[model samples]
Target: MSAPEIYEDGCPICKERLENGSDVVQIRQKGADGINAASVQRGDNVDVAAGCKAWLNEKFAPDLLETKQDVVDNMMLHLQNMDENLHKGHVGEPKSTIHQLELERLRFVLTSYLRSRLRKIEAYFPHLLDQQRNQTAEDPLRLSPDEYIFAEEYANNMSLYFRRVALRHMPTAQQKLDLSKTVAPPDLDAFVFLQVKDRQERVLIEEATDDQEEYVIDLEENSKHLMRYKPIAPLVSNGAVQLI
Candidate 1:
């Protein structure tokens, strides 16, 4: 048997009347003959869309929730040890309180990461402008960035961001020979890339030089033991590292 259907209707931001434009989202049971016997579709506004639709997984899906719960579980394991040491009494520190605090901290970190990535993605990938626009309309609180416009709008409220990075690009044999002679190929350019995560993050410091321009790429250490990237091709070609 199919589950009962539900609907949620709200006035569009521009609509004071009953219907300026109404978005209809419905949840209906798939017929027995349907390929998937059990499935649901909800509206774009729904935390979980009830229907089969593209962007459903990205916008509203339970898979990420499951993964987040796994992270919370791992956090609790370390929090447990802290609690044992903090409370020396026979009645150990309250496990539930510690768990809740740890979960809250994890959620804050995850949300911040997602917001930063969403802004960067929107800035670099112009093709997503339409989707971002629709999302901003539906959810006014969504973190969408207008990099050019927002800079001026929030100019007084913003702080300058500066980074120093070290990057080494693997060069072709011929390019290496030119670089060795203090000459670099015209097509080659250098840039530093940083990836951020909970404990495991990478930082690269790089120097980019053009005929008339020289720039430094800034890299920071948020956590300890940043991985060192060996220049494999250059090292091998220059007989610095023996290749098997």
Candidate 2:
């Protein structure tokens, strides 16, 4: 896909910020056709491009990925700052329209990214909550703080509803809500399309049937492939590959 039209040099606010060195936003030239943008900070950089990729990955992945809290927070701050700047009349006419369009596009991405996560939470609350409860220090967080709260409440509400609606009338042994038997986990074996950002050697591809031999394949940088999500789940998490 061609790069999104959100980045434009015509905006006066961006131009002024660039001249004054007050705000730093840069479009990265390498990888994925220069679709990634970076928001440079003092100690760390918040990548808007990475955020966009994460949004796509979350949208396509069956399971919830880690929250890009920094990207979301930075982009929200950018939107607020631009809105305030526009109100102060720093940008005029066509340039203001450009700024407004950029803001709207960003807002759509941020909203949709969060919405996708919420949908996943609603669908697999039981499994997700269990995973959260059992997570170890080495494990990356699966849910943000707000999402964790939402999952807990959702699971409790569902359990309460089940009891009130049907379980109350059933035998005591049959009244318990066994989430493992009731809730379906995300299908790790589901096929997904992805582009390799970094070349990986001997990546194993498991066979769908016992009759077929499992094999390993090299994922060359920038190469695209259609494969099961399970083996490359770690790759997706680490940014070695991006889900398309």
TM-scores for candidates 1 onward, in order: 0.21, 0.82
lDDT of each: 0.28, 0.76
Put down candidate 1 lDDT per residue, 1-244, tens digits, no spaces: 8554322242111112224344332222212111121111211121111111212222222111101233333334433543553354334333333334433543454455344434443333332333335554333222233433443333222211111121123333422222112322112122212222223212122444565444333323242222222322222222222222
Error of 2 at 63 (Å): 0.8
lDDT of 2 by residue, 1-244 (tens): 8554433443233343344443333333332122222234222344557668879999999999987787788767766765786677545565566556666777888899999999999998888888889999899888988899999898889889999999999999888788657989999999999999999998988755678877889999999999999999999999999999
After superposition, which runs of candidate 2 have C-alpha atoms over 4 Å from their true positions? 1-13, 16-45, 90-92, 207-212
Check candidate 2 and list the clashing pairs: none
How much does each candidate deviate from the true structure in C-alpha RMSD? 23.0, 5.2
Give the Å shift of residue 64 in candidate 1. Answer: 20
Over all chains combined, what TM-score does candidate 1 have?
0.21
